[model samples]
Target: MDNMDFSSFLNFNTVTVAIAVILLILLVSRSLQRPANVPPGPTGYPYVGCIHLLRNRNILEVFRELRGKYGEVFGLKIGPNFTVVINGVEALKEAFVKHADDFSDRPGGFLAEVVFKNKGIGFSSGENWKQNRTFSLSTLRSFGFGRRSLESRIQEEITAYLDVIEKQNGKPYNMKDMTVMAVSNVICSITFGSRFDYNDVKFKQLTSLFAENFRLSSVAGAAQAFPVVRHLPGDLFSVKRLVQNFEDIKEFINEQVIEHRNTLDKDNQRDFIDVFLLQQTKNGEENPVFDDLNLTTTVMNLFVAGTDTTATMIRWAILYIVHYKSVQDKLRQEILKVVGTSRLPSLADKPDMPYYGAFITEVFRMGNIVPLAVPHGAKKDIHFRGMVIPKGSFIIPNLDSVMTDPEVFENPDEFHPERFLGENGQLNGKEKIVMPFSLGRRACLGESLARMELYLFLTSLLQRFEFLPESPDKLPSFDATLGLARASKDYSCRIVKL
Candidate 1:
């Protein structure tokens, strides 16, 4: 053995290799560490556990049923992982606000690390997460998210959307493609100093790719739930596709940055890429986290989070308006009264338009696109509401139940905009109850932009046209299938220009 060189074997067992193994085992061990006193929930099969709960078509329904039996905070066994979900508003508040610091992190999902390639704001953690998130929130504000300047951009996009529809001339149309493109342009303006034409093949492909990935099933959730599934052939195939999608998106953004860099004035930075390039210039070579890779990821994060979520919300808004005639009539009357026929409604007018605002608020509730606010991770163990949310626990505010909580909202399931309007016909206290933008530190970074886009676009559309379902039998399915975001199956309508 000594003659065969004992040092070779020792050298082969490198510290880096040992550390890598230790970290991998730690992440693996996370699936096993259920808290001693978790919120009560249905029992599941051992090891493989309630992962089966998420496997089939009825998973969202399964979750809804679980919410019924378990009240608000309840556990669900997903393979070896036991996630404690805080459903309903009170429980959501408790988890999000009262104990916010404990739960203000992106969950340690195997999919996030692998799929995001641990890139920027959406998945990355620590100092980079803080800087990027803070910068994003701050930048959007400065660039007029809910402010007047941003309203003009939204109006421009809406006009573009209207122009396409007006060309159709009282035609039965699937506005889904145009809707996503309109919203994507808003983000493009913010992120890259540009917007895509609605017919642009690239825009369609990106939107479709993102939508497909976001609406993944619970079997995929189980694979995400348990990292071991990641190495399996099928999981790796899907992930490779997602990564390839990201590469396509990144390649486009990277080229845009180079073009911007040649013509850019650091002081007169027009858009997000410009701002980021300036940051890179400022940070210089010492910059570790704010490098080009992270910059691209941040731009992608804005595009992904900012684009589809708002588009889907607005699509759902139009769907709901078409689904309910009375609500549609009320909205039209409000639009006629507040906005008038000639010029479109602006962000400044959001204050004067109470019914319109309330309708938008209810749209957010009824849409329920993100049923669970993106899962948060426990930074450290802390006692929250007589329960210990242990360190590194996967924490989720099940916002679906929050919006539907009967106590706070009267007949929470009903699509009544009046719920958001007070006794004197003003915007009501319901927004405080609505957590669509979520709450606390990890709340959606694009909340203001989303809110502005929803209100202005929805009001503008109603002002310009009356959206009607194709027939009485044509109510769009409200069954929100589970994914990273909830998406409706399909719905088409005819837009009659008023």
Candidate 2:
């Protein structure tokens, strides 16, 4: 009986081992396999794909190295998702502009499911995106989005910004908090029809939430790529916190929406919120797309999108000026030459300030704030430049590649504002190629407002103060803390009133 049992056990063990070997082989083969004619890329481990590649590395640097090895268009299997990184100006323009429809969808995964839930302008796709975008652009334009009329509102925030900075009294101070406040208020004036005081506790909390989510969202890329990561026992990638932040932001927006609805005067529209409420009332029951949820999400998208990014860019601009005193001197000189010290700089002055324009362009390039603009998805199976991009694959536009391309800008690494100028010291048309707002249908919706803010704020600050380092010997590190936006490491500068 014992001999029989031993033989049976050995047979059972052999069967188990055979099954395990077969499964391993199948997994390995499946992981190694690639869709036919897809762009060449690194084949990562089974199931996980190239997730480990991004574990400790900078994503932009990783893409740059991959571009070197795999050419402009490269692929990576990020978990179960197939991602294609598009590099260079020609390829980006071709994919985004030439074939805009085919490459305009936002990938549906963790971000879409949890954070955005297929709502809002930033992440929604198809008819929903079309309707919202069309209405948004039209409405924003009506309210002076890219027009000269909006300059006065932007100037209001700048005055508030300057007053707060003046309180610092030339002692070394980090401009981040005040900058965020001022920039956010610009969005507030347009969206909520009111701007908050710098010390408003609720407003401060709201902005803090936006800033935190920006950093957390960037860190949650792994969760975004791999939905399974979000299911882990603990909030390993801060996914829970991110979702909570969204909920908090949504609640705050909902309150504003409720208030707007109560006070909404359909005959006399005041702000974006008032217009949206009127539209909702007009299309009640017939148009489900213009519901409360969409209103809340759209407002959230505009508020968050309009605030953090512009603030970060302004902060980067300040850091660059502080680091390069020569650039600062030149910028101030140009501002003085054009706008003069009598009043804050205006959009009308923009044409005459070529050096200032070049300086801003250089900041956009060197800052590379939104390094990889929000990931776009393949609307369908796309065939471009002789390679197939499978449907639903993540399309990453490496804006860093285009901005830093040596072919386009000589000494791209060096922060030389003069590269944007012609022999006559006027902005050469090269500034046209500097696409910090990105390109095509899915480009930043707030580009005009952002440009207006950057120009006015930077010029005003330079017009009034000299941004000197706390210590001449120890300039703030040009190194950036990478997030959804590239932000300069926090540094205080001595702001001397000129």
lDDT by residue (tens digit), candidate 1, 450-487: 88888888888888888877766776777665455677
Q: Candidate 1 local accuracy as lDDT?
A: 0.75
**TM-score winner:** 2
* Per-candidate local distance difference test: 0.75, 0.86
TM-score of each: 0.87, 0.94
The TM-score between candidate 1 and the true structure equals 0.87
**Clashes (N, CA, C under 3 Å) per candidate:** 0, 0
In model 2, how large is the Cα lDDT of residue 123? 85
| Model 2 error, position 440 (Å) | 0.9
In candidate 2, what are the lDDT values of residues 1-498, reduced to their tens digit?
Answer: 599999999999999999999999998888778989999999998778898888888878888899999999999898878889999999999999999989888998887767887887888998888888888888887876433246788898899889889889999998887888888888878888878888889998998998888778665687876777788898877889899999999999889888888887766677888887787777783575787777778888887777778998988888888888899988888888877899878898898999988999999999999989989998689998899999989998889998888888888899999988999999989998888888999999989888988898888988999898898887888888787788888889999898
- Clashes, model 1: 0
RMSD of each: 6.4, 2.3
